[model samples]
Target: MQAVKNRNSSINSIVESVFDKDAANFWLQKFNPLWSFNQALGKIINKDQTAVDTVSLTIQTNKKFKLGEAGQHHPVIVTVNGRCFERTYSLTQLDVDHVLLTVKRVDQGIVSNWLIEKAQLGDVIEFGQPYGDMLLPQPSSPLLLLAAGSGITPMYSLIKAALKSNVSTPIQLMYWMKHEADAAFKAELEMLAEKHANLKVQLFHTQSEHPDSRLNESYLNQVSNLENTTVYACGPSGFVSTAEQVFKSAQSFKSEAFSLSHLASDDVGFINVTLTKSHKTVAIPKGQSILVGLEQQNIQPTHGCRMGICNKCACNKAQGSTKNLVNGATNTEPGHLLKICVNSAQSDLTIDL
Candidate 1:
């Protein structure tokens, strides 16, 4: 048996030395689309409309894919019209080989629209290793999950994980949506709350007949042990900011925003951005992310999780000034690392792209 194993290893080494991996994988994919040398690929097996303009897809991934923590995000890559596009989304692991990806349609969003309208069952998509920090901690504390609109997706993942782990602490979720019909996993969440005594689910609709007020201090009355609970909030930038202010008294706070709010900047008009590696210069608008500006000029940079937490979009600012959109901080230092997804050009800049 040992000699046979050694012979097989020798044969494999010879085959690897003789054939290029890309060439081998090209032929391998002809038999099975998900087969690859090392790439993580998933096939869409099921699709369901979870809410108005929201969809949930069941993806069965190849063995190369590594499952991430409950609240982590994965960089999903797909090609549309021969052009590859990558976007990050939170995934809920259903089992060892399956995950649920929920997407909400955004107006003028190219990838979201394609995933909703064009992607079909048996279609294969590429995935990057999961990246995020908002995860459940050991020796758990009470959890306060605050979500707005599509933000509920990650919270749902965290909730199921917490319950499955037998976390005894109270888990309270407050989700806000424009209308009740916009709520994804409404019945599922209610069912979970019914089954788990420690889990509490609340839905707030701002556009309903009896509208609920937006995030404010008054809502704090409903949450018990406010000062002892760890809080996780996800939503639009404005909603996250409001949550941060409202839940300042929590034991610890973590947040991720799906969209960034436009920064109010005195640096108006376009600024020239010089790409050092490409030896090209383009003018991009101030007060907007450098990533968006680059995309406007059809310059695609490798990026994931546009929320700035993934660090995949970080590049060196070789010269000039930039302002951090999240905190409104300015940096004029040369050769500083800048996350193009969250930093706006404040002046003519040269970047190591």
Candidate 2:
């Protein structure tokens, strides 16, 4: 028995040495397209047009995929034109094996356009671990959810989870879009509001004949128990900033911005960025994100969720200064970690690519 065990162990070691991970995975994928040595993959099972420029995809994930909280973003990776790109999208779990991802087609968005127009059912995509902190609070308080444009995705997930949990707290959702035709989940949200007496749904169209003003202090008037409610806002940076200021007195406030507004900085002009690994130097614009600057120079670094939540674009700032675009804070420390997605080069910098 001891001899047989030793022989079996030797054979296993030989097999491991012969079949490297990539070779093994290639064969595994041939048998099952979603199978891999270690990759979270999902197949597009269903697709539906949610709005004029939005589509909701139902993805059936493999066993490697892990579900996240209601209000979190997942880094989805897809190949477009022989190049891999990653984008973070808010997902709603439909069941143990499936989740829903809604994407709005931006005018020039590469991943969005591809996902909307090119991806088909049975196509597999990769998903990284989910990230975000705007989850439902414990011991639920009366809730106020504010969303604009595609920001409604996560709020929809949170609202569904909150309602399904049978939390008796009042949930008021105010969603703003350019037009009524751009509203996603309108009928579903209305049905949910009708069934739940504690729920309220309001849609605002900013470009309608009777145009509603953008989110402002006056919007707080519609939210009852503002002092006691937990406020969650998602939108462009400007709208989120406005929501934060107007709801400053709420019990708790959390927000996520899909697009960051550029910081108004007195420091203008170009700064040099030296990529240590690539052994290249490039001039990056001051007061703009390093990731954007690198992209402008055709240097595509690994990045996910350009809004700075995933930390996939973080790198070592070996030298010089950078400014955090989100908070307008400057850091001059050397050998510190920097997230290129939300930080701008402030000086001649050495970075670990």
Candidate 3:
């Protein structure tokens, strides 16, 4: 298998040299983009018609695809309304060549709605490498998977991977959502739990007639055997925060939130932020990072893993002072690269966003 994988790599390298992506895809896709082995060039194979407002896409990629951890996300790019959007979606590998990406349409979710309503089969989409560390750790032990809303995407992956890998450790899943229909992978999760004796599944419908409408302290206290398990939660900030606090005494606990938390708000007044390339100036709030401020003003800058882990949101600070929220380090140098996801406007700044 190692030799076969090596041979496949050699073949892709040879193909990249002979058949240039630019010459072929220029007519196929304008301004031919990089079609590298490290990238996921996927074509939508199918969509769940039975799925309601949320849509699940099955994408088929080539053998050169980079495999992702069970609880990681891929930054997928799709062109919608003449604008390209890079949104991160947790990927569930159906096979070596296929993945399932479930996107829920939010009220103001430009990309999410576009994907569900407009994206069609055979449409091509580019994806960054799968990333994030919220997976079942090696040498598995008892695990509890807590998820809400779209957070089920990654937790689903983790559960399937755990069972597929033949890990005998028990996996307890408690998924929270507004209603039964709102649960994206309800059917598959039930099947998985039924098939794997070691897997347990529970659902909390926050707005439905079902019991248990929340994942709060009261619910957390009733959970059994949590002391010996690793708790993994993914969802909105509030859900994750609650899980963190509730499971603090567990063996281990981790979480993934869709959005980054803003630094503590300060009354430092507005700061001038100048976009060097666009030649536009905007007044950003005192504590708000440039990324959040830009998004508020309808400026969609390319970014992924909004946690400053991926360099997707990194930009050049040609001239200005910026403070990194992750480390609280301030950079006053004229020309330096900084991650806008965690940095805020420290002064009148010019950035190549």
Best by TM-score: 1
The backbone clash count of each candidate, in order, is 0, 0, 0
| Candidate 1 lDDT tens digits, 175-267 | 999999999999999999999999999999999999999999999899989899999999887788789889999999999888887655567
Runs with alpha carbons beyond 4 Å of true place in candidate 3:
1-21, 27-39, 260-268, 272-283, 294-302, 307-311, 314-339, 342-353
Pairs of residues at least 3 apart in sequence or in different chains that clash in candidate 2: none
> In model 1, what are the clashing residue pairs, if there are any?
none
Better of 2 and 3 by lDDT: 2
Q: Model 2, 1-353: lDDT tens per residue?
A: 99999999999889878878888778999999889877899999999999998999999999999988999999999999999988989999899999999999987999999999999999999999999999998978999999999999999999999998998999999999999999999999999999999999999999999999999988877988888999999988778878988999999999887888766769789999999999999998887889999999999998889887778899999999988777577899998999998888888999999
Q: Which regions of candidate 1 deviate over 4 angstroms?
A: 1-18, 264-267, 274-282, 318-320, 327-336, 348-350
Give the per-residue lDDT of model 3 (tens digit) for 84-158: 778888888888888888888867888888888888888888887877888787778899999988888888889
| Rank order (by TM-score, best first) | 1, 2, 3
Angstrom error at residue 118, model 2:
1.2
Which is superior by TM-score, 1 or 2? 1
The Cα error of candidate 1 at residue 353, in Å, is 3.1
C-alpha displacement of 129 in model 2, angstroms? 1.0
